[model samples]
Target: MSTKEMFLTKLKRVIRTGFFNFWRNGTVSLASVLVMMVTLSVIGLISFSGAILDTSLVELKNKIDINVTFVPGAAEADILNIKQRLESLPEVFLVTYATREETLAAFKERHANDPSILAALDELGENPLGAVLNIKARDPSQYASVAEFLESGNTLSSGGITIIDRINYFQNKTAIDKLSALINAADRLGFALTVFLAVISMIIAFNTIRLTIYIAKDEISVMRLVGASTAYIQGPFVVVGVIYGVVAGVLTLLLFLPITYWLSKVTENFLIGFNIFSYYLHNFLEIAFTIILSGVLIGALSSILAIRKYLKV
Candidate 1:
């Protein structure tokens, strides 16, 4: 046979032998797969953590809207015009108008059980609350621009009188700045934790695979005695390891579906409808790719490590 043909034959033989060993050692293969599944699960949790963190930050930022309270007796038409103008700004995402009546009603409802506050409201006998505009920006960084636009142009009526009593932008400025820093720090921490957990899990998983490989030492020694090349000897075990990873990666993905569903229900009730299961579904493809690739690499690498030590023949 030509050299190319010889190489092809050996490659085919190695693959066949690898598949055969993997199937024949069913119990060992299953154990290796289970170990890998645990590792993949640890890595998969990174996705969940990221989704939860992002959702919480978004909810917080949404709650951080700028409040523009109009002076008492300010005309509703002017307030609505300001709302329209704020909406026109490119940086603004949403501008909601709350009339003085609605604001008073909401306040009264909140203090309904508090007799002292309710009596105080009754004494006023008049709605002192002003109509307000709540403004949200497309991003936290754009909040400054939105606030600046509102202060610069929208505070005064066309009659040149101050219609806006106060803007609560300064009240929330510090929190918004901290939130931006929190987002960056959270992203870095998430990445670092993922890497840390992945490395630790890989170490544990491969050790389990290595132990399984140790049991097949006699088989490896015999193949060496028959003058098998190192690649030929290692190839089958490598394939076996790859199979373990593939199986585990698939199992881990399946496992997360039900787990996230249960967690989603719990969080919805306790955490104001933050659905982790939805996040899982949305990012399933990216998550699957990462887990499966990690499994395959870990399995293949561990198998090679085993071969190096046990293929001492």
Candidate 2:
């Protein structure tokens, strides 16, 4: 037979043998599949959760912005000019100007029930707040340059305008930096856990498959005695591994979808601008391929090791 035909014939035989073997050892095969499914499910859960957490942190960071309060006498024209200048900066992504009246109105609206504060504000006869420029930076570190620009009374705040009286750089900067650091640390820790769990799952699946093969040692030896070539002897085990892999992969996908959907709902605002379902659906093929590949590799390696050690082949 030509090489291609021979390979095709061997592949057919492998499939036939694998099905027969599974039927003969139905209970063990089912148990092996169940174990593999559960293991892969755990792996998928860990991966999905880690992704959600990372995305949430990024969304949180993007929501944070720096507030620059202008002096009481700063001109509206000057403030508008500063807004334009800040917007032109490479680091600044967005700049919003809020008038003093708007600021006080927002504060009162937020704290409407505080009668004491309202009475005190009324006694003052005028709003104590100032026009504030809200700045969002493309890069977190770029806030320092934005702060310098505001504080130095440069072009934007120049012409005796003193648009920015004080910049609350330390408060906003510290909060953003601390949040970023915490998120980074949490992500690293999650990654480590994922890796560790993956290894453990791989080992467990491998051993389970190996144990299954051990129980079939006599039959494998009988096939070898019947003048079967090594290829013929090993073919069915490899085919069985492939079957396990495909089943485990499908199970993992099924378990991941609903769980991700539920989590997305629970963390709606926290994970704004992110769609977990869309992401998984888009990457489903890649994730499925990885899952199947891992299962097959573990199954094949375990089968080979078991047959070699127990069958003394």
Candidate 3:
């Protein structure tokens, strides 16, 4: 046979043998698929939980910002200059500048329902509000660095006068610190858990493959005795492993559909407006790719290693 035809013929034979082997060891194959399903499900749930945590944390982060209010008599040019300096900071996400007039207007609007406050403001006859710069950091952890930059006496305008009256970061200090710590902890814990689960799954699947290969040791010995090449001997088992992974991945996806749908409302309520089902549907392609690739690698690696000792025959 020509090389191409020989390769094609071997490929077909390997696939056919793989199917036969799968059905021949039907109960063991089923157990392997079920074990892989549990692994894939855990990975999928981790993705969902991570999404919910990230969304909720972002919402909370958005609500926290540093409010820098200049003194009432501070020059507008100086305030604008301070705003420019803050904008130059790499850690800063946004620096929203509100003129003194806009600040006064906003204050009045907020207290519109309170006649006493409006009357008190009118009695003053002068705008007590200062031009404000609302600073948002790119990350919760970066807030401290920005605060340090501010406190480093960079608030000095062209003149020797200190324009900044107060920064509200100290007020939100505790909350920001806690949030930063929580985000870091979540990231570390998520990575560790992913590694832990994947390793455990591979170990279980690897042992299961070993047991199946052990059952076929006699057949492998006969093939080895008949001068069968290593690749030829290993090809069918590899194909069978691939089949197991693909089936398990498909079943995992189907299984998640109903489970996510059932818990959609519960997740929306408890996970701070993030619906697990919605996330699953939206990120289906990415999730499927990850789970399927993981399954394939795990099964194929297990089979390749499992048959190593038997190949000596």
Candidate 4:
């Protein structure tokens, strides 16, 4: 046969052999597919959980208050000056200026349902609420620096005005710190879990491929005796492994939709305003690609290792 014909013949044979082995060794193929499916599912759940937690934390941070309230008589111009300075600061994301009137209105709105609070507010007979600069830091960790800048006599009271009052950073400080710590801890744990599970999956896949090879030992030996190349001996089993990986990936994607929908409903309040279903919809392609890539890599590597050991002749 010509060189091109010879190559074509080998390709056809390899494809046929691969399909034949996968069906003929039905039990082994099924087991490998199921094992990979479980691994993929675990990884997917971990990824989804981590994304939700991170997003929820961010939402909490955004809502956190670092109100810099000035003395009741502080001038609107002075408060605007402070707001501008805060806006210029690198650590600050936004600085909202609320006049005493606006602050009182908001306070009354929040307590509108509570007659006692409204009565108390009316009895006070004046807007005791002070002009406020509600500052939002670009990052939670920057809260300390931003608070210090606002409270320092230099940043806000630089115009020799005694218009400054107490800054309310202490009340929200603890929550922000705890959330930052939680995010850090979750990230570390996610990394460790991913590594641990990857190793476990690799081991399982390797053993499954090894078992398949063992079952085909006699056939492999005969092919080797007939001068079949190592590639020829290994091609069929690799094909089986690839098939398992593809099927497992598809199954993982199908399983993820219903599971995530239920989980999102259950954890809606816990996740603040984060909509897990929306997130999945937006990132579906990325998630699917990751699952398929991981499955294929694990499947291909395990098959290669197994065939190397058993077809060493």
Q: Please tell me which predicted candidate would have the highest TM-score against the true structure.
A: 2
RMSD of each: 2.9, 2.6, 4.4, 3.0
Q: How accurate is candidate 4 locally (lDDT)?
A: 0.81
If ranked by lDDT, best first, what sequence of candidates would result?
Answer: 3, 1, 4, 2
* Residue-level error in angstroms, candidate 4, position 208: 1.7
lDDT of each: 0.86, 0.78, 0.86, 0.81
Error of model 2, residue 193, in angstroms: 1.8
lDDT of 2 at 251: 73
Query: What's the distance in Å from true for residue 189, model 4?
Result: 1.3
| Per-residue accuracy of model 3 over 87-143 as CA lDDT, tens digit each | 988999999999999999999999999999999998999999898999998887788
Write model 4 residue lDDT over 97-187, tens digit each, in one string.
8889999999999988999999988898988889888887888778889888776775545568667777778876776788778887887
Candidate 4, residue 154: how far the Cα is off, in Å: 4.2
Candidate 2 segments exceeding 4 Å error: 2-4, 153-163, 261-264, 269-279
Q: Write down the worst ten-residue block by lDDT for model 1.
A: 267-276
C-alpha lDDT of residue 194 in model 3: 76
User: Model 2 — which ten-residue stretch has the worst lDDT?
Assistant: 153-162
- Prediction 1 TM-score vs. true: 0.84
